[model samples]
Target: MKKQLLRRIGLLFFLFAFANAKGQSLYEIVFEASDITYKAFLVYFNEQDAYMRIGYTYKGKYNVVDVKYQSVTGQEDGYNYLVMVGSNPRFITNQEKGQSYNPDHFIWVWNDQNPNQLPYVTDDPNFDASHLIQCKSYIEIDPKTMTDSYLRQFFRTDEPEYQALRKMRDASAGAINYNTSDNNSNSGSSSNNNNNNTGSGKSKMHLLLVINTDIGDIGQSCAVDQKAMEVEFREIAKAVGMPFEKYIINGEKFTRDNVERTIKSMQVGNNDVVIFYYSGHGFRWSNQTDKYPQLDMRYSEYTPLTEKTSLPLSAAAKAITDKGGRLNIILSDCCNSDIGRNQMTSTTFMASRSFQGAEIQKLKKLFIDSRGSIMITGSSPGEYSWCNINGGFFTLSFIQALKEEIGYMRTGAPSWEHIAENAVRSTQYKAKNCNGCKPQNPVSAVRVSQR
Candidate 1:
């Protein structure tokens, strides 16, 4: 059944790319309003730009290709939608051909109330002709959080997830032009001076994943968030063929002491790549000075919120930096608001994918090739970091941007600075576009160099 489904994924058809997900992301979505199950491939050029190859089947045999390749961030709700503004639905059967209109837009919604619910399109069916039958623009589609396994299923053959990553990059840069094998070979064969990495030289990198998923208020959401990070961080290592040592602190062992002990005692290669990711409640202390938020290390709702329960992001960065790893990255996806909102230092850091491929060269541009100390957060010091059941908006956006940097979304030198910029912009859009949500401008500090 899966292979048959894969066979039907005709080229040049529109796709959701699993909801502005990672670069070269592909997803098959079913809307509550239509019988047609849509397959989509979304590749982010940047947060403000994306290409969609919208496709659906006619009578379960023919593929409908309506490619509307444009940026579809939810202007109405930040990062919760893909507004394909057109009235034409392809009711035809053809092989790898163009449509009268681009039908590349697909809708995905986050089931905020029921976290376990698979994404069922929530767009109302009673809209005008301009909108697809039941496809509305408010459903949240988190393309950035998809696991590599589901991604692998999209190709009919047993293509490696990384290989698909390349095809998607190429398909994205050359929308409707998925057959760029010759060009890819040429590019792969060519020398790339920018990717001459100076890191620890293919040794085991280090990834530290810390999550407060068992904490009271947002525990459920945090669990999913933690899982996504695990998948993503591992995929990063796989994409670049980097051997890695992973350290995780969560559940009953989640405490400030554990994180501190782990970091202070952990041994990383002097030139290794180390990344620290944190997900949970975060805030600023009344007397704090840094722009990043502190980790809410408490593992249970009954735990007291005090100095013992928290770890500042800066301290973590400095600790990681002190280890002398060649390339270091720390990301905190909690709020930066004052501690308890009554200006207790207030509350919210408020905020907000993956792959492999020959575009593997592109991956080198950001991962294997760069050097520096980098840190980013989901929101500014005073705003609330927003999230639903899917994950933190900031984390999802970071994945999206990472995919963009490695995908064939652009040409020339791949850049860490560009990836950081896209992360901030994408998270900002998700916050700014929401109805009750306040605007969130993420904060990032980077001191990295790429040749």
Candidate 2:
């Protein structure tokens, strides 16, 4: 995605059962580039707290390396990548058991579903782009369910291997930086997260999940997004000490008519929060002057992109904002790319991670204290919003960023600006060298209200 390219992570090893811990998210990605191939396993906790086991064949036989790495999910370029960099790799080779430490400037920059992605690793921190290797056929597999005989050789999470990884994870647990997985589960306990909002009245939150679960292209991504948003907003509700009501607009009910009716007819109050989130296809028309993308609400694949079939994000935000809710959040996770071209969707790798416990005060500051409207689209105009088998990059980043902003371990004050900035970077990070699409930079417009 940039001048410093991937030399195939010098060839990376991975582990399979890095899958425990409800507070963590797990994955195994297999990709090939240049003369090297990688079957890498990741157990992600937060942005910085993650582990990797890389097995690769450099010149001859297969070699396995244990990487206790810190990762940054999004970068600044048009390319998006999960950048894992570490030092002092512990090797488990064919010639020996776990060997002595070898210091190397090891790095793996990859995005699933084939972007302009490559895994880089080298002893020289300033390695040139000439050595960079491009990866292809990137796929996420469940080792327990996979049938590949070759990958089975590298799938070891036995006692010794597990212990080594445990040491790696424990070493970084105290690091103050909060860069973890987007699939974080330890947000907070539901019981403790509930309390009085302002000691005046009970607040109600409306979570509108309008998705295109039936669309073939982005349906899977949307479905996964649907689930992730549900869990996240519920955490938000609990954080703000409010009761939330959920409304689903998907499948046959995903028509524009249905979506419009739902938003226009909702009963919202002054203390309420309306989160109108749409996940699926999005586009921009030729004459459209608005920077925000239009949501394609057609129910069938054969349906035409008409005025009746499309809805602008501004309209949705205005509609929800008109209801007099305390805070109105409009999130659109889809493409703002080529005219009428559907966003490229990849196959499923696994569901999407997070911090364990959430800080109630942080949550109150963002959700309860903040007022007015927040509009976030996954991409800016003329850019492609990226999604893989994992999930939509911007959506994942929003949740990841949100978790960090409110996590007890996070430093500094929590602000929506940080979340918006991170979401844009994260989306760009995942889109780097992506096969089908260009760089995606998320756009956010916030109007703070004094109530």
Candidate 3:
């Protein structure tokens, strides 16, 4: 089956290239609202190639010539004869002349006996002529007079007929006309130069995953965060249609310098969705500053109090702001040691840390003031972020939320706010079930003005 398909494809390409080289005038006979109701039938004719490609909307899917050398013979009586190319796999290995041939040397004979009967081809009772009975428009196209842009518009634009079919065709072919290479790069130079968005017209959303599993204080062999998070991260990214660059930092590798370098490597575009996710140990300084509250990066060369081991959370907001990203999100599945930041003044905060607290309010203020981004944390201040053999509870919950929230999206991708709501709910549920685990409620600082 594959061989036959490839052979037909090769023949089509050869025909197109050959006709173009010979300066042959290619004409397309288009019928609007013809046999295919509310759709268009485009038949291409090349005198040099003596072949035509029949493009049709069949069963709501656009299929253009799956077979080769289908004949369309027009007679002097203004009637046309068609012999559909047979779909057989053996034609690939066997190039016998009988596969396609002119019937009866283009002979035409009139038998007066068929005057009271329908055409022999339409004798099949299953054939439906209800749609074929109407003819809307019959137009001929000259490829020479039409610019490439005009030709594309003539076939694709002008109405709902061919517009949908053209889009379907482009999507089925992996959107080869669009450049998606920039999605892979982490460097600033790889930012998209093309002004156009993706084929779906949605802004390009990029993700940066930072997983730091091993805390040197906890034996390296015992740390299992990297493997656990990566599995779910990939699944979530695939479902959301977002491409990501991942960094797995373990043991002494999770240093402030390394984190800064990774953060600096990213370049977000103005019309892009940028997300940064970190899963590991985290802590706020005992003397936290409002301008730059630092989170301790677990397991590095520096001691606990040293600046080399601490990462400023503001850096993330700054990086995203520097690139003028439209939507920015930061997720930290880690713990903070400062209780001052996590003030439980409200009954809601005391009951469930996931509820709005001083910590969340401060973070919200920080982000809105800095870059108008959103922040989600796995646990409230002074609470430990729990993890089992599978992975961090918060990360797994976030992934689960993504699956559910993304499923609900009728069109395009889910908003970050929706995802955060689901994640917090799911995380609270997961934390409730774990025995001996403190009630860990994930919290978020969302800024609606950014949207």
User: How well does each candidate superpose onto the true structure, as a TM-score?
Assistant: 0.63, 0.63, 0.44
Q: Please give the lDDT score for candidate 3.
A: 0.42
lDDT for each residue of candidate 3 in 1-451, tens digit (9 for 90 to 100) = 3224323333443343345332011233333332552222232211111223334454465433322222222112322222122221221122335443111111111224422212111111122222122133334443223443543433444534244334323433442221111222232212222232343244444555555544544222124444434444433333234444455444556666776776676665555556676665566666765432355665543455566666666676566557676667777666655521111110110011010001112222222222356777777656666655445666656654543332211123345566677677656645553444567777687774522
Of the candidates shown, which would achieve the greatest lDDT relative to the real structure?
Answer: 2
Candidate 1 lDDT (Cα, 0 to 1) = 0.58
Q: Which stretches of candidate 1 lie over 4 Å from their true place?
A: 1-22, 26-47, 52-82, 86-127, 130-202, 340-358
lDDT of 3 at 280: 57
TM-score of predicted structure 2:
0.63
Question: Comparing 2 and 3 by lDDT, which wins?
Answer: 2
- Alpha-carbon error at 221 in model 3, in Å? 11
Give the poorly placed runs of model 3, Cα more than 4 Å off. 1-205, 216-244, 247-251, 289-294, 300-302, 338-372, 408-414, 448-451
Put down candidate 1 lDDT per residue, 82-118, tens digits, no spaces.
3332333343344545434333333332324433333
